[model samples]
Target chain A: MSHPVACCYLKTGRALMSTQRPDARQLPSRRIADDLRQAIETGELLPGARLPSERELAGQYGTARNTAREAIRLLTDEGLVIPEHGRGVFVRRESPLIRLGNDRYSHKYRESGLSPFLLECAKQGKTGRFEVLSIDQAQPSAEVARHLRLPMSEPSVLVRENVFYADQDPVHRVTTYIPWTIAEGTGLLNPEVGHPYGIHGILEERGHTMTRLRESVSARMPKPEETRYLHLPPAVPVLDVLHLSIDQDHNPYELTRFVMRADLTGLLYDTPIE
Target chain B: MSHPVACCYLKTGRALMSTQRPDARQLPSRRIADDLRQAIETGELLPGARLPSERELAGQYGTARNTAREAIRLLTDEGLVIPEHGRGVFVRRESPLIRLGNDRYSHKYRESGLSPFLLECAKQGKTGRFEVLSIDQAQPSAEVARHLRLPMSEPSVLVRENVFYADQDPVHRVTTYIPWTIAEGTGLLNPEVGHPYGIHGILEERGHTMTRLRESVSARMPKPEETRYLHLPPAVPVLDVLHLSIDQDHNPYELTRFVMRADLTGLLYDTPIE
Candidate 1:
């Protein structure tokens, strides 16, 4: 029942909450999560701070132990705290990932010699790297074939898959698909290992200039295999984005199924209105 | 344990699955959720389809009763099913909520007399409506203040709050913040009951002439209040977005916080890459 690490955090957080408006009529689970989330947001409980155990929280809040556990589960789902199997929960470490926005396509970034992902990391004062999980020539899903405008008789596509790491965390898993004709003709069917700017550079070099993109985003609980592959924790959802990379001629030469840990990533879109 | 409604759905879903590739290696809970979700997607279980009760699912899947309940919870989180207390779960009725994209500021939509939200619903073959909750002059939170570029001494902001419904389901709860200067000068502070295009119309007429929009999108578990207001089910996450609306002179005129039910909404972003 003892909480050795959370004792100091509790004192500071309570003092901080007193100055704010009352929580008003939230349930025990919500109040607890809100209190801790506030503590995390306000810097009363720093990242990596160990949270009070369920038993200690139950005793402190005078609520049933299960309610306290639910509070932690809520925070876990919010990506505010992470539980380490036998070790207790700790405030989740948050490292911002640069949202690869429309600017990544700019000639400046492409000419800078750093991949857009790496440029983003540098801007954010971090380092980025990607490890290739695979590169293969294979028949694609029907959705992919359709997006690439490949004929039903088309046989294969060059699929390049990798896990992008930001701040040493595996943040994104991407699978890029290109039709066989372009893949074979552009010499992208077999990539030279670890090219800068990833596939965008390859496409640019081959005269397939990417000018527009259409992206659809959805959230879903990851399947078990995805959980393992993405290192996602329980209650963490995946942000699945389907991107159709269009060229100057309006051809969708690249179709990417991008998956990111919802708990950790934020996407930004900025564009001129009219 | 008897399921009067789901029996025919199961047979047809199984037949459909046979023609499609089988789901390999998914656990019992996942396979159960996947089957029902497939049924929902393929029209075997149409919108408002009554899902089998937990007991019925348990009997059908040969899983522990709790496992079947977990399966239902998964679908609920995906926003594919809605669980009504004492009434069992139903396939969630989805009406598209048009993602407020960069094009909303385009003269075409602005001049079309339909607000972007209305235009989106119309495009998807449905009607959209919004009910005003409250309008007041108040100090916004720090985040909103920053986005509005309000000076510290600025007294108040005109806050317009409303809930948007698509096909009678509450889909978005938004709070729009406008700086005091604009609020006072334009007579928008205590204006009419509704503006057709919402805040954008007011801004356009007042010469704000929005030229750019920056949006950040993330997902989180809805608060208890949000659950009540939006009628969100347990485990369903809400897609939370923050918008910074900018004028030609690079001044931020509107700061809007938008919350939408994740299960029923798909956000599409189409933009020029470079």
Candidate 2:
């Protein structure tokens, strides 16, 4: 039996075994895949090259043909190669696509003529509700002022906090900001109206229209308060999406910071039609 | 002070408390938002209904006006409410988009392209290589055989396993498979071909043209081997994407399973284009 690829495969196989000794009998395909996979990595077989026939492989490895097939199936799944029916398989070296802002609502839902939250809700076959935690008019904190683009001396700022739930599950926590100047008219400064239309409605009623949005995302370990509100098990990481919506005039009308469970919600992005 | 919406908000807030104490700092705006959010949930607000004015809501809750405004903003960020500049915030609801397979891949790669591994590498401007863990041909277990639609009595299967790394950091662990019959004539079956083209390349050459793919995703606590290979922290979870690709004849030629670190990869889905 010719052992051309076998030698290279064996060398790479040993390097892989150095980490942990797996249960050989339970997962033979894994062991076989690892052997040939290592050979490819070590450059024993050049890229865009062809592999030996299955009969040849079985003889060299002393394994059944099905096991060899499993090894090949694993590589094909990773976008590492292209398989042609009735022909043969070849190496694929195409670079994985690199996308930016694809997880953003601004990119995915902007065109649906619906808000990002609504889109997310209906997709899950669930509904969303906002349970405002606190609403207060106070001197803008330095951080709040920076985010809302309010002056340090801004005498009044509106802070609205809420926990968002889907199917009775707490899915999001957010705090939004609005500077006093933009919020002062039309009796919006009064808290007496209970919870009225969201800021978009109020701003629109006041003649300001939102035209653009910006967001920054980061991941961090969840805090206790977050765990309690989100019903998260300890140590579940959170995806923080902090976004600001600017009106047509390029003025910041709303600054929102959101904390969400990383696993439950999947983000989607759509490229702007060219 | 009237409390038209207070009762509704309090009832739900109490349910969410998990514990019994009611915190006093919570204001009417919160109650209103909560109440309105609940209304939305119970279908009381309907998807397109207009909410009361800030003054109207403030009067309804007997709170100051700013409180009412803040509550609305909270709903906006959660994607429950759509705030049009001039059009008061209305119930923003829409169905989920039907995503195409190609779109899904494009989005996932774009959002986290070359994330941590690439980030570190690019910052230093260095290139890395794939390390083979093991490669061999093995018999397919019942499960592998079922997925491949192959009979158990057929020749042995081909299985390949590998771990991808960047500077020794385990990025992903994969198990690949290919059937013996198709691979028998192809050089891929031979051990001497060793580093032959990636499996995809091998199949393409063998006349198996792959045009469609199916991916099933699940999340779980990482296993010991997964933890060690990916070097994942205890708190982080693992996401497994099982890929099955069939040739033009509708026969699955490859089945590859990939385990990725949740912290390192953020999966993105794209809304199908109409």
The numbered model that scores best in DockQ is: 1
Q: Superposing all C-alpha atoms, what RMSD in Å does each candidate have to the true structure? A: 9.1, 23.5
CAPRI quality of model 2: incorrect
Query: Residue-wise lDDT of candidate 1 within A1-274, one digit each (tens)?
Result: 2232332224334433345456443566677787888888899889999998888888777666877888897787656788886789999775554666656556777566777778677788877888778788899988888888888887589898889888767878988888877777665655564543556777778779888888887766675567788887766767778888889998888888888877667678887775
TM-score per candidate, chains pooled: 0.77, 0.39
Clashing pairs in 1: B79-B263
| Candidate 1 local lDDT, B1-274, one digit each (tens) | 2232332234333422344445443466777887887788789998998998898888787666776888887777556688888898998775444565556557787556677777788788878888878788898888788788788998479888889888877888988888877867664654464543555667777778788888887766676579889987665667788878889898889888888887666577788865
* Global CA lDDT computed for model 1: 0.74
- DockQ-derived CAPRI band for the predicted complex in model 1: acceptable
Residue-level lDDT tens digits of model 2 in A1-274: 2333333235334433444555442354565666666666677655776665555566666556766676665555333445556566555443211112333333344445455565456666767566777877778767667767776556577777777776677767877777767777645544443231345567777766665565544444565457778986432456665667666677777777777765465333333211
| Angstrom error at residue B174, model 2 | 9.6
Model 1: native contacts recovered, as a fraction: 0.65
Model 2 bad stretches (over 4 Å): A1-127, A138-157, A186-197, A204-212, A218-220, A233-237, A246-253, B1-225, B238-274
